[model samples]
Target: MAENQWSTAITSVKPNEIRVRGYRLDELMGRVSFGEAVYLILRGERPGAAVGRLVEAMLVASIDHGVTPPSTLAVRNAASTGASLNACIASGALAVNRHHGGAVEDCMRLLARGAARVAAGADLAAAARALIGEEKTAGRRLPGFGHRIHTDDPRSYRLLVLAREAGTAAAHVGVAEAIVAELAAGGKALPLNVDGAIAAVLADLGFDPELANGFFILARTAGWMAQVIEERRREKPMRRIDQGAAVYDGPASRELTQG
Candidate 1:
């Protein structure tokens, strides 16, 4: 190896071949779902069949929360300024900071702390109550409970079901459920939102907390691109972007048909 040369184990490039985590890129193209490929590239191992589905569900759950989300708004605003696609996407990515698209990582850390308490022989509910009390005493809100919109996030329920079916519901998931139950029992009733569910599922699936928000960024990139395209095609340049004044005129309720 050359002096001071950097190296990465993520991918290898040769004259006419490319490999990711030791799998041939061309061969992996059609054989694996994007979620499975993502798992392989990130974790350096192929996911079990059900794990891929759960991962895909997690991606879908955060694909697009609408124009109100900061990321999407950033994308749209950048697009309206006649920015290039990459630049607009970069703008959106930058908006995914601590308060916006970061709940997954934050919640994963919270769940990990609770899971560690449980591992040390603390009762799950008791641990949860203690954690909640600590957070309350600190005047800090729980990262993944409650939402500005839905009382019960449908995506959260679906993701958790998929996680259990995928066999990835373990300690972190149990801790999350315990926290929710504890909150409810205390008359607070803060439901576990989608971020909390993803955090638990990802933690149980052996993902590091650092990569939690990356899942959201990957999924939401698709929506950002769509928003960017729409902004370029429909709106005048340099116009103000207002989330509150936006209305959905694209489609009404619809059903998907299976072939």
Candidate 2:
């Protein structure tokens, strides 16, 4: 927002138009599906139609899941207390932190490393094992391989199924399957959750990992905007929800006298 400031989500907020990374919207329209456009916007060029369409569809599929999503719940809470739509949306987005949307980026990093090892002629399973080992050694869970909610995340499985059905490659799809399989072989059922599958599919299509978060945020933005708009239409704000400030429980100290 300052002079010379820019973000790689690829936007020029001039001429009353937004060109995501220099490609005009008009040129992208109909020529690419929403997923391809998303890929192009983030990566600077469109991938093949099949891959692009698959990614776009994944984005669309995740837009919103009723009032259950935290963002939507935050918007609703804001509406209940009489807050502006934008304010409600900001509040909601504030709640989604490193723990939530961060997995895709982490997962992609692991895959990139594992893929490199595999490409260098290491066995695929061995590379995956090394990847998991490295993450554990770092005191973290292997990202993109599991979820907290589902015994095996059905949402992820369904999305991957659809992406594969839409002609996403077997190899990329196999990466996801292999991760799940490897996890299972360890006597764990850490299925490929949404983040892992998304990472594998996107990486297969050649998008940079830097674009991963932006692509995810774009999809999340739609859901956020929709909830914000809905809250706006409801004509009430969540004054109570935004009322309280933090209760400090840190160390208390007596005032020090200057010597």
Candidate 3:
């Protein structure tokens, strides 16, 4: 390696071959799911089938949340102005700030704090309570505990169940649950939201907190594309993009057929 040359361990490109984390990209195409490939690329190792399934579930859970979300609105608004697909998608991605799609990383850090206290001989409930007190004293709101629309988030419940089934529900999951319990005991009664559930699962799965929000961005990209395409196909150019005014006129609820 020379001082003027940069290096990357993420991928290697040659004249006739491409490799990601030392595995040939072509070989990984059919042998692994997208979630498995993501894990392999990020962690530099393949995950078991169950873990891969859990990852895929997490992605599915966040694929869309309708037009009211800031990202979706941004996409639609940009598209209505006749923005290119890439630009519209960029608009959506830019909307994923600290309040919108960032709860995953924030909740991961909160869980880590509680987990560390538990590891240091504090009781789980006590640790959670202490964390709550600290955040209260700092006048900071607890992230990932509540939702504006959902009293009990279905995605949270499903993801937690899948995490347990995948054997990845460990310290962080326990801490998250303990926090929710403590919140209820304190009369707040905020249920764990999907972001919190993902945070716990990813923390237990040994992912870096900094990378947590990337999962949300990746999953929601599909939804952004859909919104952009719909805007381009159906809406008038330069129309006002009102988030709350939008109504669903799509297909009725239908069950998936069994294979």
Candidate whose TM-score is highest: 3
Give the per-residue lDDT digits (tens) of candidate 1, residues 94-208: 9987677788999999889999999999988988988898889998889888987788889999999998898789888998999999999988998898888999999999899
Compared with the true structure, the alpha-carbon lDDT of candidate 2 equals 0.67
Candidate 2, pairs of clashing residues: 35-56, 78-238, 81-237, 81-238, 81-239, 82-237, 82-238, 83-237, 83-238
Q: Which stretches in model 2 have alpha-carbon errors above 4 Å?
A: 1-24, 27-31, 66-72, 158-175, 225-259
Clashes of each: 0, 9, 0
What TM-score would every model get versus the actual structure?
0.94, 0.71, 0.95
Alpha carbon lDDT at 30, candidate 1 = 92
Cα lDDT, all candidates: 0.90, 0.67, 0.91
Q: Which residue pairs collide in model 1, if any?
A: none
Who is ahead in TM-score, 1 or 2? Answer: 1
- Worst ten in a row by lDDT for model 2: 239-248
| TM-score, cand. 2 | 0.71
